[model samples]
Target chain A: MSGTINHGLAQLAAVDQGFFTDRSGGGCIQDNKLFCPGWVADNYDRYVHPTLQHLVLVGSAVAAGFLIAFALAIFAHRHRWLQTPFLAGTGILYTIPSISFFFLLLPITGRGALTAIIALTAFNLQIIFRNVTNGLRNVPANVTEAATGIGMTPSQVLWRVELPLALPEVIAGLRIATVSTVALATLAVFANGGGLGTEIVTGSNITFKTGIIVAGSIAVIMAILFDAVLLLIGKLLAPWKRKQALV
Target chain B: MIPLPALTLPTAAFGLFGDAFNFVFDGREAETGGVTVGGTSQVLDLAAKQLEVTLLALAVAILLAMPVGLWLGHRQKGEFLAVSAGNAGRAIPELALIALMAAAIGVGLVNLVVALAILGIPPILTNTYVGISQVDRASVEAARGMGMTETAIVRKVELPLAVPTIMGGVRTAAINIIATATIAPLAGILTLGDFIIARNVYGDAGVLAGAILVALMALALEGTLAGIQWAMTSKGLKLKRS
Candidate 1:
């Protein structure tokens, strides 16, 4: 136990003491040259674990947020009186800032992906909840009335009529939440939830431009990829909206 | 605002809430040495710096974004540009943006402000455009009919009507600016984030104190902006909404 603790201290010591500890081999690295493609190529494999961790962080948080917000939206839909309080609660969660949120959670949840996920998930609640509620509420009352006339129960009407109409907005909210979460998840390193941020914030200072560019590009790519996938899913679900767009 | 902070019971971060508050309001002993780290004045200075940068970056974003967003909105042009810009803007990682700006451009108040402003721009621009375009067409038409210029129509009719939405964007920008400013210490701006990031210097109490202060500052600024938004709304619009 002491060995592990000593090793952890040693690691932290090493991080603080050096700007570029492994810079001897490559001329590019030795000079601290910006955009060291050669060094990046050699060290590219280092990012694999952090990449996966980041993916899990962004993915699970968004998924959990959507579920909770969707349920809340449904409840608020049923009981109109619940809307204000729910909005205010989620708004407070959304307002706190992610770094502060992560550390604030440190004492309670302990560090790592769960704490990061909880914070990220809480942040997402407001965006998703607002969008989902608006989407549900925006359903033309006439359409629901027709569904009711067709012998549809309230739950059936909600699932078949209201949710389908709300698809575009819900998906739009997802895209925003997903993209922002991808960016925000980089800060998860502070909580010790590894992500692409491990590369950028490798030390007390970030003198290594190459590391940042590589990690940031991957993160941006991830955000775009997530966004595109969500967009395609929305398109598939709302085919009529697609057809309307084409005209 | 990018979805933001969360809170719960403070645990291993420090001894107790009282201790943390005391750490903020009175100098605290560091873990390694007998050195005193944080106190009321230090905390206040850091808070001021954070607020200054947040407002500065927000002002830069407003100045840069509002004209473009308002004009696009007034003309009903560049919907794709405005929308896609906001979407694309969301994708830029905050850490990456900060680290890269520091690495490439050199670190200082100017660079940090520029980096934070980059974040604030998108939401404000998109919202302003969205808000202005969303103003009732009839009102704008009536303004024009009453011998108003395009500028006057935009200022008098569209802006007043779109106040809530535009302010929503500004509010979003403010939240983002303040949040991002917490990491300004990474780029060498010693805001409240310095306490959080330099855990070695301040220890757990300092870190927790920093977190608490940052959270409170965010809430306070957000509340202030909410008030501004309310005050900016035309009384007619307020009553109509009520």
Candidate 2:
């Protein structure tokens, strides 16, 4: 019985020495361990702001891109001649990699969220615009003619009939754009437009694995959430299609 | 880190661009050693390194992704796998990918190749499957009726008909790989990105120069691939000239 008490006291001493304690107390950072669980738990608060910044960046860029691309698509839908130029313009922008696009904006906009957003918006143009145009084109001719026979104006037919049907493809484009932007926005660190990448790239130690893992995981989760939400929105917009599935 | 007096305006920016252009054509002096940093030869060498690394990765990806995509496509299986791969690929953060890979597995040429090849695979795989799936089923039936071997049918019919779509995937993969390669310097390989990444050594002009050159290279590569894809497409299959 006395020996058992002594052993318990010895184990307590080991805990006191910090062996049983969290590695966040310093040892993990010192050793540069691959993944310091304790260190991550302690340090995760630092990533919150950067994560928010990343969200705002993606939201603003995609919103602006959709508006611009949607307008262009509508206008081009009427004027067939505009299609080639619009496609060519957006195609060129899409071909330029986001990192290069970011830096190329530096001289013009300087480094900040504006530069990052503009660059990201430029990247979104092609994907969303193409889908919207294709969706508009793919609207069945009979549906339009039926709407016209019902005394609906051309403008009414487009807004009420064509745009609603095009929602599926538009949402698809948004999902692609949004997911890609979530991934691409990490490069906003280069523009000094803070994001999770700020944590991944410019920490006290950049190659620190735990920091990268934390940031990357958050970005990925954000992407998945965005993709799911967009998909749900698409289904909600097309309740008729959802009901069809029930049958 | 250099604090310039007043070069933020567009005019001043244009001047900087001019300096960047000069730096690429005629090398600028290094801060210490009085050596030239960027000129034609050095830029060309780094660009070449980027291309070499890109091609190596792309070749590996084609070898791995194509066969699997083609096989699955032939078997008409793994639709979920093929489709999800494209979305999942888009979701991977490029910066974190490189940083994490470098941190987790030590950086080298071979390791970099592995990183880029994996990045390039999904689009190639997805596109290959979609391309093969889109081939007219009747044509495959016709080939089979003629007693052509499975491999022969795949090679002679599906591949030829699917060239446009298949090449579209290659173009996407190539653009991605080449783009990612501009950041290869972080992993210890010297590429054109060194000029941009190492701003302290090369200054703003070199950085700007690096950005322009990388953009041009990516666009040029895309254009060349489009041309090659156009050539590879069979004449009878040329329905639309988009």
Candidate 3:
């Protein structure tokens, strides 16, 4: 509603100020606060972002995507009839190009965080679903049977046995999805969702400047940080691997 | 909302002038006329030419990545540098890197290839790393224990085991590179994206047409790679064919 209008107007204003205009001489003159000149301001508006907004968009997408993936993975595994078709369907969804999906989804959902989340979630499902299915299925049948014999219900078996066993692989999938979603989230910038890509696109259209480079670098750095954090989490969760307990 | 009619009117009118240009000076590269036909023709030619470059870049990337990735997989900690460097590499956007490279080496395909090469590296590296790392440890140890040399172990055990995963990574990488390659037109190399970007400047129809072409090109590439990936990786991997 009101938020969409403001977002559009802001982007339009950014475009109109000639800030994203060809080399130099625009509203950017007053905001020469950019880190570099000529080389940076080329498309300043597109690249510039307040750090909080960038993190919030990326963080929320990753968190929500993880939850959705977890639920779908469990649903697919419990119902054999649903497993094959569910996994295959997500696979096809994975192949759709991001921009086309964005455009297609935009008409239905409109351009905003929701569209970006839906798009990213769809892209991530295949990987997460595959990993979760494999992780649970790979859990030793002996272990599941032992739990059942011990009078555990299916839910108890899943919660207490299967999930713990599958945690390592599941975490690995999450790591991949996190890094991927962060990078893909940049495309949302085109819809005026605000992230690192805005800087890169704006920088290219204007005189190349350091601000644009910095912003772009920051985006990359954020992605790297996300990767590192996920890797660390994977390591922490899989201490058995560190202990040399299993292959 | 400009609506469809408003968007269509100008391009439709320009279509008449473009048609006239085709009628009068279509064949000759007449130095004197302000014929719009040349622009349209050049755009088409450039789109095709860019495709050729894309194929070249992709072929080169695959050829180069295969050996390097396979080699990296044999080591105990093969993914160390690949993952770390790739994580860092993702931070540097293709557009910035292209500009920096174009500035350093000048424009055209050289810059495009170099930028694409850098762009192409991460997926190949990550895939090779992941694929090789995922190789069954016992199978690898068994090969090593059988008096197989390190090279033999790689060639016989690790590589075959890793092929599917590595190929999957390649498939993903190829799609990514193709999608990003559209930016090459901005560097003044007239790829399909040039039409979209240029038309974006002119009006929506040109941009729309450009979008259609780019989408088709990307879809065709993805399908081709999917087939290739299926052929290469389907041997042992129980990938449910879509």
TM-score of each: 0.91, 0.90, 0.71
Ranking the candidates on lDDT from highest down gives 1, 2, 3
lDDT of 1 by residue, A104-188 (tens): 7666666677888998999999999998898898899999999999999999999999999988888888888999999999999
Docking quality of model 2: it rates as acceptable
In order, the TM-score of chain B in each prediction is: 0.92, 0.93, 0.75
Better of 2 and 3 by lDDT: 2
lDDT of 2 by residue, B35-63 (tens): 78999999999999998999999999999
Model 3 per-residue lDDT tens digits across residues B1-242: 10111122555546643543452224323233443423456656756775776777767777777677777766756566766655555455555565445543567887677677666667777778777767888998898788999889887778767776777766666666665566676566777555444432433333334444555666677678767666666454645433
lDDT value for model 2 = 0.85
Model 1, TM vs. native: 0.91
Candidate 3 chain B weakest ten by summed lDDT? B1-10
Q: Give the top-scoring candidate (DockQ).
A: 1
Candidate 1: which docking quality band? acceptable
RMSD of each: 5.0, 8.3, 8.4
Supply the DockQ value of model 1: 0.43
Off by over 4 Å in 1: A1-25, A243-247, B1-14
TM-score of chain B of 2: 0.93
Q: In model 1, what lDDT does residue A208 have?
A: 82
Which one wins by lDDT: 1 or 3?
A: 1
Better of 1 and 3 by DockQ: 1
